[model samples]
Target: MTTPTPVVFIHGLWLHATSWEPWIDLFQKEGYDASAPGWPGDPDTVEEARANPESIADHGIDAVVDHYASIIKDLPVAPILIGHSFGGMIAQKLLGQNLAAAAVAIDAAQIKGVLPLPLSALRATLPVFKNPANKHRAVSLTAEQFRYAFGNALSAEESDALYERWTIPAPGKPLFEAAAANFNPHSPAKVDTANELRGPLLLMTGGKDHTVPEAVTRATLKQYRHSEAVTDILDFPDRGHSLTIDGRWREVADTALDWLRRQEL
Candidate 1:
């Protein structure tokens, strides 16, 4: 008997790990062992995370990468990673380190070498950057902010419902680390984009995303130009950052499943 492949779903800032529950169930039914593990310092539930924001504060990019790495080390085989936002960035770092079989980065956050920073991206993150102290804090978004950052492609009503259902306070440290990545030679946001031996990577971007715009994803793609390993990108022209969690999330998941099948992973 053969063991089923494992799939790990990593959520980005503001959304609880459970936001990936639907994806996990679907992946499981399709014959893969799937789980969505929360980031370091994350509580077991969204309510707990919200009630104790301090418990989730002050973790940086390195911490997140390490947390996921530790989990991967314990797995029987390296899992295929599907990450959104900062989680996407974490997936890339892990895949580059040869820790995962393959990775699908959806609306991933900017890494060290990505240079294009759109105004909307700035605006989307302003809530965390406005106060320097936020770097050591956990920040929550208002419904309006959530709408702009993750749900621009959805109606306001749908956006607000998503917010209520899955949103949680997110640590601000990763944002500060990514924002200063280029300036820091030892930035934690660095990814081994040049690893010719790394596993396949698929970068998925939302054309209407405000948090991580299309230009950023395009530039991220260019960063992998020197690698011989498979590094592909897919664009959802009408989608926003919420493409992975919104009502139409099935489309994105199916796209990823199709890509993985093509990769034979």
Candidate 2:
């Protein structure tokens, strides 16, 4: 019997591993083994995460990245790494260490080549960076906030429901780190994905996403220009940063699945 390819999913900030439940189901049906590693102390459910937001306060990029890296180390076989937003940065970091069979970064957070800081992105992150006290706290989004930053392109009911189900307080430090990434020489947000010769790397962007705009994604793609292996970019016109949870999530997952199948994993 052929061995199944392992798939590791890393969710973006304010979300836990459960955020990938639907995608995990789809991957399993396709004969793949999947695991969604939580950021340190991430609660299993949105309600629980909200109830204990303080637990996530110390989960900075380096800590979260190392936690996932440790999980990868114990895997019997190298797995395909898939991540979104901050999780994307972690995926790239893992790829840099040469740990995955392949990787897909979706609406990934600030990384090398993504230098633009659109006002909307700033506004979306303001709630976290408005005060120095937030640096060590967890910031939860209000319904209106989630609507603007995550579900802007979805229907009201769908957006509201997603907020209720997936919204949770996220560590503030990572957002601050991403905001200062370009200027900080020692930012943990930095990743040298240009060494793409390691394996197939796919960067997926949500065209209508205000948080991680298409322009930013395009800039990031340029960094991989010198990669030896396949480096590809795909944009979903109608999707927002919340593409993984909003309506039509299955469509986005299928698109990624198609790409994963082509990799011969």
Candidate 3:
């Protein structure tokens, strides 16, 4: 018997999993069981996360991947995974492992085999990489940094509100691990792009994004070109890294929805 499709939402750094509530609502109304589970040690609320930034510290790529992998393994059925930023990387990893029915990666962080580190991506990771010590700590973004990295398309007022509501300190270890992935042969940030067992995978990009811009997603697409399973890429012009949390989030959500529907998922 076929079980209902479960849509698992994975959130990136600086935002709680609940940030996906809007997307969840949209998916649930469309007959999908949607959920957003945070990384290990994630605080229950935005306020709690802000105050206890260090609570999620010291976790690396393997740990975060395992956390989400375990969550999906317990689901009633394979899920249609949708994730943004670092969360997007997790989606790809799970897809490589054949743990998801389908996957959508939005402005995804670079995995080990995904070559090409855009200057924008490097700049965005500066907050954590600038200080080598941050690998063992948590790093928070200031208003200007947040604006530069995520909200450039938004006004000051909109950026501030988004920051107040969604931003939180993120663990630095994962960022470090991702940065060194290509050089580290033993890096856990690798993905199995050639696995035939992997399902349809889509890469979504923000044209104006400073972090994980179109170039980055395109590079990932090139890496996945070897996959016999369907692999595609879409671009949302004028959008930034904040596309997932910004006002036009619905547009991006609908695009993903339309694609999944086409796949009969």
Clashing pairs in 3: none
Per-model CA lDDT versus the true structure: 0.96, 0.85, 0.89
Report the candidate with higher TM-score, 1 versus 2. Answer: 1
TM-score versus the correct structure, for each prediction: 0.99, 0.96, 0.97
lDDT of 2 by residue, 230-264 (tens): 87899899889999887688988898899988887
What is the number of residue pairs that collide in model 2? 0
Quick one: ranking by lDDT, best first?
Answer: 1, 3, 2
Q: Tell me the lDDT of model 2 at 94.
A: 86
Error of 2 at 26 (Å): 0.4
Candidate 3 least-lDDT 10 residues: 218-227
| Backbone clashes (count) for model 1 | 0
> Regarding lDDT, does 1 or 2 come out ahead?
1
True-structure lDDT of candidate 3: 0.89
Candidate 3 lDDT, 123-165, residue by residue in tens: 9779989999999998999988999899998898888889888
